[model samples]
Target: MTMKGLYNSFMYAARAHAKWEIETSFNIIKNRKQLLILFIMALPLLIPAMAHAADFIGGKSAFGPSFFSPTTFYGSIAVGVVAGLITGCIGAGGGFVITPALMSLGVKGILAVGTDMFHIFAKAIMGTTLHKKMGNVHAGLAIAFLIGSGLGVTGGGMINRALFNYNPVMSDLLISSVYVILLGFLGFFALSEYIGMRKKSPKGGDAHGGPDEMTALGAKLQSINLAPMIKFDEHVVPGGRRISGIFVAICGSVTGFLASILGVGGGFVTFPMFVYGLGISTGTTVGTDILQIIFTAGYGSIAQYAIYGYVFYTLAMGMLLGSLFGIQVGAITTKVVPGTQIKAFYALAILAGFVNRLFALPEKLAQMNYITLVPSTAAIITKIGVWLFFGLVSIFAFWIIGTFIANIPKLRAESGYDVEDTKGGVSQ
Candidate 1:
């Protein structure tokens, strides 16, 4: 490859990866096997929540917040509805809201992260199913990517715990800062995609890009003939494009690390990585992401966060229930709504998160004496930011639900009048 080739390779990879980061999101549901697993793994975490009312109800602790108040119940439901709407339609930005929303509501930072992961784990069990085609997955690709992701999660979990132990205030600031950056980047691209769509089709059409394909840069990398090569998705690729197993694993590790730290399923990161980096088919990528979320979220929530007493079970359960309804409604709305509007909403959700964290940062810094500021000023600003975020999210959720209601006759007509049984939502 020439110098220009090298630069292009780098830029192309960035572009592809950016697509993955912005486009990946979520879906959810349940099975008996998952319930058994959750029971076994989360038993310890839930026991604490089931504690006597003698325990502090709203009190914050290293363990987590005590639970089951009317306020907590309603609040968790509201949060889940908006989050589900984001995940169902936009395919990103939902999980990003949970931790920040919880923290703003006075849940401890670590607890909020853990609870979100646990909730996702439960949701994945319910929502995810493997490829309808039994042979859909490329075995070599799945194994390599999973190995890499597992390792990444282990490393990320250690880092998160180490930071918390080192300085709780610093931990809060760091997590907040990471969210601010991630949400800002996502929000920017989402708005850009929406704007591009509007400019191209003033009458309103789907503007989001189509299914990802292996680009020329990806093709170049696949031709390297590196050692430990793996041929994947031969059905889609005539020759079954080969890439080094090591390369595949490295991509998985990056995805896993980000997912674990953020307390998400990692689909948002993994989808693009597989499709663009490894050049996997979108169909196969979706299958792989579903499997990966179950493993990643479970391991991170139980082994990494829950073991350290950082999860909130009641909140997770509440969100799970509420998301089922919200995701269903939002998914239906997608059929009637324009992709441009979805992109706009996605941008708003992400930007709201960015603002929430950005405003909360100074308060955390002041707590650590990293900066000097009046407590009242910092608190007021943080309060405003959090409320503003909730306001935007509320607007997004109501709009989606209202749209679904308004379009019920149209949707029902399309579905042979089987609206109740044929919701056909996997609750992504």
Candidate 2:
């Protein structure tokens, strides 16, 4: 496939995943049972607050100040809001920015990964409505995938912890290096696509430019009669298509490993792997991806990170709250914004993240004594990256909010609500 085709496929998958996340978040908010569960999960925050009180009263406390802080709490919410805005407006998974944003806020890389995983886990649990999509799911395929993913999650978690124990700087370096590579590749392609669209049409084209076709690799894999074949897409084609369970498991393993290491819930990777690599029908891919996220994120967070004291519950909750609000606003704002502008922002946002991680590398390298550099110079570079990233994100957020506010009258009118102007305020 050509580079452009590959990029389109990636965007299509990412958009689908983002839509699921947004819908799930909204459902969780509207469901009383889910809200209650969320409340129960947040009850743990009281423990940290109580500990803080004890320390304030001149008593010893096991919980450190790091466990709960006002600044970090609010900062996490802001990070989540920005991520949600990108996801909602750009129609792609905004999760790519979460870890880097956390790291920029002085969060430990491992802790950030763990916290993000927990956030995704909480969202998945509250938002999952598998019964609705069960018809699209292939039981045999999901089972094989989960088995491999379990093993992959375990291995990935171990690697991260081992690096952290050996040298915290090394752990940060690994995580930063991974983001740099990923964001750089995605960002470059995204920018290229944006430029291509501008040249082709004054208005931006659809984010997903074309339909996905089965790849040559996928065709070859399906033809192989490896043991334990999985049948799927009976609804789509006669006799349905079958691929080896082994291949499904392999794809699951890669997805799990990346999810554990990056704390992205793996949905972004799962979609492409299933649709493009394995040639699964999109219906099956979507249903199966949702199931895999709940399991992969839950297992990776609780089994690997939470139990190890790496997960920050407060931050996770804060982000969840912020993203819920942000996603709604962003989705609505997209109605008024031009598609081309949204595409440009998406490319810029990814590039900003790439720059943030890339520049921060020098500081980690300097601390590890891997490179000779002045500490001040390293700090300056890192600061520049942080400013550039947050600056772009802030601008996007403001624009979305501004558009939403400005278009409120029109939005209200469309929704059959009348707006009345008062002396100093407007009421709907």
Candidate 3:
């Protein structure tokens, strides 16, 4: 496919995934049951606090050493807030930056990945109401997909663990390399899209518009009448479409593998693969993606990472809490910000993450002896990457929060709420 076509596909997928995440965040916070469950899950962390503040902050005990330093605790929340802001404002998946941000904050690459997975799982469990959306789900298709995803998760987890056991540097190298490849393509395209939009429309409207059409590849895939065909979209298409279960399973495997290795929950890619590759209708794709993410994230985090002790429950909970608030504020701020600016910031944020991971490579390479370099010089480069990444994200977060605060009166007026009356505790 052409670069522009690829970018469009990517954005479509990301927006769909972001929509789910935003909804999930809202649901988790709004529902008392979910809030109670979340609180219960977090109670164990407080047990450490009873001993001594210092004892809880990276202290060792019979159970294990805590990774609960104040810096890391608050830092993880900051990371989640920034990510949530990007997702809410840009209308695209902000999760791409989470693992990179954590790694930059001195988290072990494996631990970062595992913790991210757990965070996603927690969000999915608390926020996703699959029963309400199951009308659009094709049970057979979901089953086939999960079957393949399960195997993929296993393989990916084994690969990461094996690398870590062999050499921690190697594991970091692998994860960083993956991000470099993904973010490099995405960042370059995002920047290009921003420039193109600026030229076409001074004040950009919607970044993506137009109907979702089946791609040529999607058509070809659907034509393959292998046995055990999984039919779907009967509600949208007259006769509905059928694709081989094998192809569906293959797509699931790819999604699961990426989720396992990257901790992104694989929702970003699932939409594109279903809509563009498998010829699935957007309606069906949406519900199925939701169902799958819960399973994929839960299985990957608990079965693959948590059991092995890679998942950081404290960091996961902190991110969950921060993202809930950040998404709401960022979503509100979108009413005040221009689409062009939002798109531009999204591109810059992604490119910042790209630069961060890309520059950190030298240090990993030097440690692994893959490249000879002065240790001090390598450290400096790594520090530059970390500072640049965090600096850009922090600025974006502040800008969004500032915009939200400044626009409260306007937003309230638009919502037909009297600002003066609210100050007096009246709702006239």
RMSD of each: 6.4, 5.3, 4.2
lDDT, candidates in the order shown: 0.70, 0.82, 0.83
Report the Cα lDDT for residue 40, model 3. Answer: 79
Clashing pairs in 1: 24-268, 25-91, 27-428, 28-127, 29-126, 29-127, 30-126
Poorest 10 consecutive residues of model 3 by lDDT?
A: 56-65
lDDT of 2 by residue, 293-358 (tens): 889989998898877767777778778878887888888888788888998899988998999999
When summed lDDT is taken over every stretch of 10 residues in candidate 1, the lowest stretch is 17-26
The model with the greater lDDT, 1 or 3, is 3
Give model 3's TM-score versus the native structure.
0.90
Per-prediction TM-score to the true structure, in the order listed: 0.79, 0.90, 0.90
How many clashes does the backbone of model 1 have?
A: 7
Task: Give the top-scoring candidate (TM-score).
Answer: 3
Give the candidate order by descending TM-score.
3, 2, 1
CA lDDT, candidate 1, residue 325: 62
Candidate 1 Cα misplacement greater than 4 A, ranges = 1-70, 89-93, 131-134, 202-217, 223-226, 335-338, 407-414, 417-428
The window of 10 residues in a row where model 2 has the poorest summed lDDT is: 56-65
